[model samples]
Target: METIVFPFSSKFLWAKYLLVFALFISAKALIKLPINGTIPAVIVFGDSIVDAGNNNDLNTVIRCDFLPYGQDFAGGVPTGRFCNGKVPSDLIAEELGIKDIVPAYLDPTLKTQDLLTGVTFASGGTGYDPLTPKLASVISLGEQLNYFKEYIRKLKAIAGEEKTNFILAKSMFLVVAGSDDIANTYFVLRARKLQYDVPAYTDLMVNSAAEFVKELYGLGARKIGVFSTPPIGCVPSQRTLGGGIERECAEDYNVAAILFNKKLSSVLNSFKTSMPDGRFVYIDVYNPLLGLIQNPQKNGFEVVDNGCCGTGNIEVAILCNKLSPSTCTDVSKYIFWDSYHPTEKAYRALVTLILQNIIGDFF
Candidate 1:
């Protein structure tokens, strides 16, 4: 009963209409998203840098399971934590309004409910390589990732797939290993001299670390924070070996660490670009800690060069915990807690710098 009129061709018009509908749906999905109200659970994985008390369960000679280790912590009982107090993960968890401590994965006592909050897979004296001799029956980076996978599976069982995915998607991942790899494997074992040239060895270490990160990504880790190596050459043990008072930071070791960090940063950037939804951040412990050491007066620290435990050599193995072992009365002033670790005060300051976004760009 009407004159039939077509606006151009019906086929082309239908296609355009469909395209417009698709674009509208996409926009809606991107814009009108539901806000995630829950705080992301924090999962920690690394070495002593973030280890809470995993070494307590191990028979490691390199342990802090005695007096002076937990002097700054509540109750003052040795918790096998390397520092006098909380580690980096603990501080980050506090900032996130999560649990006060990150629980160890190997703790047989941990229950099903604990998995919801998150767990720590870090072990003291562990490394990327399994062959590297450690103080305890240490866990390698691969082992830590495997433990994380197990944790996620259990989490899925309890929280269900949808909720578990949401938690992991928004959760923070803190990785603070690699120092032991250099300290124990490269420097102590003399692998740097025996196995490969410096540059080649650095690449090997960084690549191994990168692979571990990729594995974590595959397991649904969306937010990651990786710590670059601190100034290893400046550690009391290394410096002691360099000759006391005349002690200088081993530039060779520091150079290797620098090279590793540079390569690690590059790799992380590429990884982030490939996975647009994921966030990868690097914690530059090297410069910030180095700055504190070089300019201790500016940071309100008194002792910059030596540790507060045992001797100036900072010997913190089994010998450091003996009855006759020497310990500084005031641990708050010293930068190094032992030969290779930081004092609680130093660690706290480091945490503050991170929370204040001093090194926010490299993440």
Candidate 2:
């Protein structure tokens, strides 16, 4: 009336269980995300193009923390991104599988995980010119670097010294600014127009940009990509301001942008030779964006001359607020979200083109 247990049968069942466990482990490994090739994080610097909300708390009217700005973002919540959704900072991280969004280094709610992934120190209305941020009462490039230093200390605390070094060395670094320098400071505000001519002014901007890259390199960044300014004169606001009654692309603004880009490319080329260990790349957004503007229909964009918000001519930041009555019904059909910033759809296209061109050099 009693049953006897066999040791061989028990051992056979245990062997089957181990086999299944190993298979599961293998399957999981195979499907693991390729978050990055060699880069561990994506550190961003510069102006509104990549600000990612660093200006949200700053005492600057050069901010967009409410209504319509992030209408296309997850939960339709405005996170101070100057776009209808994610900006290039978020798009770049998303493309790299690093993260869905690159948090602002100054975001008070940032977590330790955000630091490990990356964060942007970019502030809207900032530029390579020292006076640019000052004029707007926003964070300057130098102040951004100071914030970066603080980020490094925090990262080291969370990730330890050795891992922090790896991240600083291998992470992708982006610098995107200068539009405000040419369009706002020199042209609209005339803050530096009387002191310096266009050629002299571009030289000043390039010098500042070059110095910034060198400082970043000294801080352990090796793979740095400085984005060329877009055709600033062609943006809706500039066209309205300087394009005369016809609202055409401001030719003079375009000229200054071209000059600055040429100098910037030259400086980056020189860095490649001088800083042999570092990879300094000049990422061109001018031609690609210009092509989009000149041939908007090619990219399914119907409105290249104006933004989706307000009159699409002058409203931006504080001006392009909730009280702006209405926004374009189809933001995807437009190239810009506000008078100055590109729409999320436009940023997606630009980011795709950029990654395709520079991924090889960066990795």
lDDT of each: 0.72, 0.87
Please write out the lDDT profile of model 1 over residues 56-95, one tens digit for every residue: 7566676677877777887976677887777777776665
Worst 10 residues of 2 by lDDT: 1-10
* Candidate 2 Cα errors over 4 Å, as ranges: 1-36
Question: Residue by residue across 1-363, what tens digits does model 2's lDDT show?
Answer: 122222323657644644553354334331232333455678999999998788998889999999878889999988888999999988887876667899988888887787867899999999999999999999999999999998888777665566678789888899999999999999999999889999999999999999999999999999999999999999999999999999999999999999999999999999989999999989999999999999988889999989899888888999998888667789989999999988988988888887887777764
Q: Give the TM-score of candidate 2.
A: 0.90
Clashes of 2: 0
Off by over 4 Å in 1: 1-39, 111-113, 133-136, 243-245, 322-324, 358-363
What C-alpha lDDT does candidate 2 achieve relative to the native structure? 0.87
Best by TM-score: 2
Please report the candidate that would top lDDT against the real structure: 2
Model 2 steric clash pairs: none
